[model samples]
Target: MFSKACEYGIRAAIYIGQQSAELGRRVGLRDVAAEIDSPEAFTAKVLQQLVRAGLLTSVKGPTGGFELTAQQLATVTLRQIVVAIDGGDMLQGCALGLPQCSAQQPCPLHYQFLPIRDQLNEVLRTHTIGELAGKVHDGLGFLKQFT
Candidate 1:
C-alpha cells in the first residue's frame, strides 16, 4: 500500500523506462500521465520528485521532459522509487496505521503484517523497473490498458 504519489511514481518510472529501453523515446509529463492514467498536474509533481531523487533526468524548454539513462533503466528497482518518493518510513510503518504499533506494543495485526511487509520489501528490492517494463514491451504486462 504505497501512497498515491508513490503509486504514480512507480507507474511513471516503469513507463518512462519502457519508452527509453524500447524506442529511445523521451517522455513528456502529459504523455506519462495519460499512459499511467494519473492526473497530469499531480503526476508532474511526482515526476519532479523522481528527478530530484536522481531516478530520472529532466530538461526544460523545447524537447525537454523526463527520461532514465540506459543503466538506470536496467538497474533501478521499485524499492528505490518507493523509498525515494515515500521514504524508508513506508517500509517500516504500521500496516494497521496505528501510531504506537511495533513489536513491543503490537497492533492487532502487526505480527501477522510484519512478514508480509518484509516479503514486499524483498520483492520490491529485487524487481527492476526494466523487468516490469520488459513485460509490457514483450506483451506480458499491462500498465493501464493492454496495448
Candidate 2:
C-alpha cells in the first residue's frame, strides 16, 4: 500500500508522536531510527523531507530533536505524509507500469482493484494522524506496534 519512503515517513511520524506522548518532549533522528529499526541516514533524510514539508520541526543544540508542531501533528493526515513522500496516487498508478491505463483500456489489475483502491483512498482521506493515534491507543490489543 506504500513505498519504502512512505512507509518510513509514516513510521517516523508515528514514532515522533509516540515519543512525544511518552517523554513529553521531542525525539532525535538517531533515537527514532533505533526505535523504528530504520536506517539512521535514511531516516534522517526522511525527517529532513518532513521538516521541509512542514510536517515536522527540528531544534538545534544539546536538546535538539524533531517534533511536530501541534497543528502538524494533530491535523495532518497519513495521506499527507504518504503523498509528501510518495506522491498523490501510488495505488492509482499502473500495476504493470502501463501508461494508458483507464476504464477504456484498464491494466491487468485495474478492473479488479479500482473499487478496493477507491475505498482505501476514502478511508485514508477521512482519517487524521491524531485520529489514528486515538484509534490505535483504544485498540492496542488489535493494532500492531511499530516501534
Candidate 3:
C-alpha cells in the first residue's frame, strides 16, 4: 500500500497525463485536485514533490499549469512515481513491518510475501502513466469511485 500522499501523487499524475495526452492541454492545480477528489493544499504539496523529482512540469500564470510531455507520459513508470513520492522502501520493506526482516532472518510472512512483492515491483516497473491514462481516456478505467 502507498501513503496517502503517494496515492494522491499517483492519482494526480494519471489525471495530468490524461489531460496532456488525451485532451492535449495542461491542467491547473484546482482542476487536478477536483478530478482526483483531493484537497488543494495537500495536492499542491504532492504536486511540488513530483515537480521537484522531475516527473511533472509546472508553470505560473493565468494560462500556466502542469503537464507531462509525451516522452514522459510514455516512459514514466509507476515505479518512478512511487519512488519519487514514497521512496523505494515500499517495494523492499517487509510486509509485516519488521525492521530487520530479510532472507537471512526472515519474518514469518516474508517468504510467502516475497513473490507478491516481486510481482508488484514488476507491474509497477512496467506500467507507464500513458498506459493507465489511456485506459481512462478510452473509458475502460475510472479514477474515482462511481455512484
Candidate 4:
C-alpha cells in the first residue's frame, strides 16, 4: 500500500510521461490534476516533490508546464518515485508497524510478508515510468478510474 500522496504522485507521473511521450508536449498542473482526478493543490505539492527529486521538470511561462525528458522517462523507476514521496521505508517498514520487526525479532506476519515485500520491491525497482506510460498510450492501462 502507498500513501495518498504517493498514489497521486505515481498517477501524475504516469500521466505526465504518457502525454510527453505520446504527444510530445508538457502538461500543465491543472491538466495533470484533472487527468489523475486529484486535487489541484495536493497534486501541485506532490509534483513539487517529484520535481525536487529530479523525476520531473517544471517551467513558469504561459507555455510552461511539467515534463520528463526522454532519458528520465526511460530510467525513472516506480521505486524512485515511491522513495521520493514516501521515503525509503515504504518497502522496508514492518507490516504491523512494530518498532522491532525483523527476522531476529519477527512480528506475527513478518516471515510470511518477507517474500511478498521482496516481490513488490523487485517490481517497483524494475518497472520504469516509460514502460507504464507506454501501456496507457497503447490503451492497455489507465491512470484514472472509469465510471
RMSD values for the candidates in order, in angstroms, are 1.8, 2.7, 1.0, 0.9
lDDT of 1 by residue, 78-143 (tens): 999999998987688897777789779999898899999999999999999889999999989888
lDDT of each: 0.89, 0.75, 0.94, 0.94
Evaluate residue 10 in candidate 3 and report its C-alpha lDDT on the 0 to 100 scale: 94
lDDT of 2 by residue, 9-120 (tens): 8877876765565456888778888876789999988888888888778889899898766676577788778777888756567667688889999888988788887877
User: How well does candidate 1 score on lDDT at residue 49?
Assistant: 91
Tens-place lDDT per residue, model 4, 50-100, is: 999999989889899999899999999999999999998759979898988
Candidate 3 TM-score, true structure as reference: 0.96
Better of 2 and 3 by TM-score: 3
lDDT of 3 by residue, 29-127 (tens): 999999999999999999999999999989889889999999899999999999999999879999888999999999999989999999999999999
Candidate 1: misplaced stretches above 4 Å?
Answer: none
Q: Which candidate leads the pack in TM-score?
A: 4
TM-score of each: 0.90, 0.83, 0.96, 0.97
TM-score of 2: 0.83
Candidate 3 local lDDT, residue 31: 94
Among all windows of 10 consecutive residues in model 3, the one with the lowest summed lDDT is: 55-64
Worst 10 residues of 2 by lDDT: 135-144
- By lDDT, is 1 or 4 better? 4
What global local distance difference test value does model 4 have?
A: 0.94
